[model samples]
Target: MMMKELHYSGSFTVNKPPSDVVNFITDLPRAIICIPNIINYEVLSKDKARVRFRVDLGNEVPIAELRRVTTDAHIELVSASGNEIRYKVDGRAAGSTISISLVIKVEGVNNGSRINWDATANLGRLLQMIGRFVNIDSLVKSISEDTIKGFIGCLSK
Candidate 1:
C-alpha cells in the first residue's frame, strides 16, 4: 500500500538566549502542556516518553499514543549558529500507524533567539485514502504551529 507523507515548517522569535530556548524546548513536561490535543504524557525513562493525544481532525478527537525517541540537545556558541533538538515519534491513531520526525533549532537573534521547527509524518494507507479529499499537509501545519506556540508560551512563563 502506498503511504501518505506530510511535512511542516515554522519559525518564530523568542525573547531568550539560545541556551534558555534549548532548555525550555527540551523539557518534555513543559513542552507537552502546550499540545492542545495532548491528554497526558507518561515518562517511560529519562530519554523516552509516551504521549496520549486527542487529535482534532475536524471530525472528532482521535485518541493516539506516541512514543518519542529524543536526541541530546546541542548548543552552539556562535550567535548565528543554532541549537538543535531532534526526535522521532511513532504512534497509532485513527485506525492508522503514524511515524514522525521533528527537529527544532534555536538560533540567537538580535535581542533573543529564533526558533525553527520542522516535522515530517508518514501516515498509513487508510489516511492516504482520506487525504486524497482533504489537505493533510495543511492540517499537519496547523498542528505544528499550535504545538510550537505552546512551546513558546511555556518558555514565556
Candidate 2:
C-alpha cells in the first residue's frame, strides 16, 4: 500500500482577538458547515462527530460519510506559550481511512491576530488511487482554503 501524506499551511489576519478566532474554528458543527462538500454534521457524543457529505471532482461526485474522534471541538493549549492549539481528527470516508493532525497558532499583531493554521492528512490506499487520477490534493486544498475564507468572512460580519 502506498502511503500518501499532505500538508497545508496558511495564515490569515483577523480583526479580533486570538480567543475569538480560536473559539470560532473550534466549533465543530459550525466549522464543518463552512466546508464546501459537507451536507451536515452532528455531534454523536462528547468526543465524536459524524458528517455526511459529497465531494465533487469535476464529473465525479463521491458521496462520503465521516466520523471524527476528538476530545472536544474546542482548542486546547498544550503549553504556557498560549500560541498553539493542538488537535487530532480521525475518520473514514470514500472507502478509506482518514487521519488529520492540526495545529493552529495565533499571534497578536498590530492590526489583529495573525491566525496560522497547519494541517496534515494521511490518505489510505484506496483514496490515494483516486487522488492520483483526479488531483485530489489540489481539489481538497481549494475546498479547505475556501472554507477558511468563508469562516473569516462570517467572523468579520
Candidate 3:
C-alpha cells in the first residue's frame, strides 16, 4: 500500500510581536487547547504532549462506521529558533498513523507579525488507500484552520 502525504503552506498576520507569536506557537500544551474537537490533551513536559481529537470525515462515501477517526496524538516541539519553530505530531487514528509535522516562521511587520505556517501529514497505508476514494481537502483545511486557531488564541492572550 502506498502512503499518502499532504503538504500545505500559508501566511497570515497577527496583531502581536514576532517574539510573542513564536513563544505561543512553541507552547504545545496551550496550543492544543485551541484545536477544535479536542477530546483529550495533556502536557507531558515542556516539549511534549498527549492529545486526542475527533475528526469527522464526512458521511462516509464508501462506509458508514469508519467515517470518524478518534485520534490519539503525541505532540512535540522538536526544534525552535528566534523566528522559526518546528514541531511534530505522531498520531494514530482509525488504525492508521496520521503523523504530521509543522514549521512556523514569524517575522516582524508594521506593528504586528507576519506568520507563515507550513505543514505536512504522512498518512499510513490504510488511510492512503482510503484517501484515493475520499476528498482529502477537508482534512487538509481542518488542519490549517486548527493551526490558525492556535495562533489566534495566542494573540488574544
Which candidate has the highest TM-score of all?
A: 3
TM-score of 2: 0.75
State the TM-score for model 3. 0.91
RMSD of each: 6.7, 5.4, 1.6
Which run of 10 residues does model 1 get worst, by summed lDDT?
Answer: 69-78
Q: What TM-score do all the candidates reach, one by one? A: 0.80, 0.75, 0.91
lDDT of 2 by residue, 5-112 (tens): 899989889898877776766655555556555565776643346666565556443423222211112222232235676667676655677777778788888767
Best by lDDT: 3
User: Residue-wise lDDT of candidate 3 within 92-111, one digit each (tens)?
Assistant: 98788878899988999999
lDDT of each: 0.67, 0.65, 0.82
User: Which stretches of model 2 miss by more than 4 angstroms?
Assistant: 45-48, 60-81
**Per-residue lDDT over 28-145 for candidate 1, one digit per residue giving the tens place of the 0 to 100 score:** 6555557666666776554466777765556422322222211122111122224888777777755677888888888899989998878788887656655665567776777678
TM-score, predicted candidate 1 vs. hidden true structure: 0.80
Q: Which portions of model 3 miss their true places by more than 4 Å?
A: none
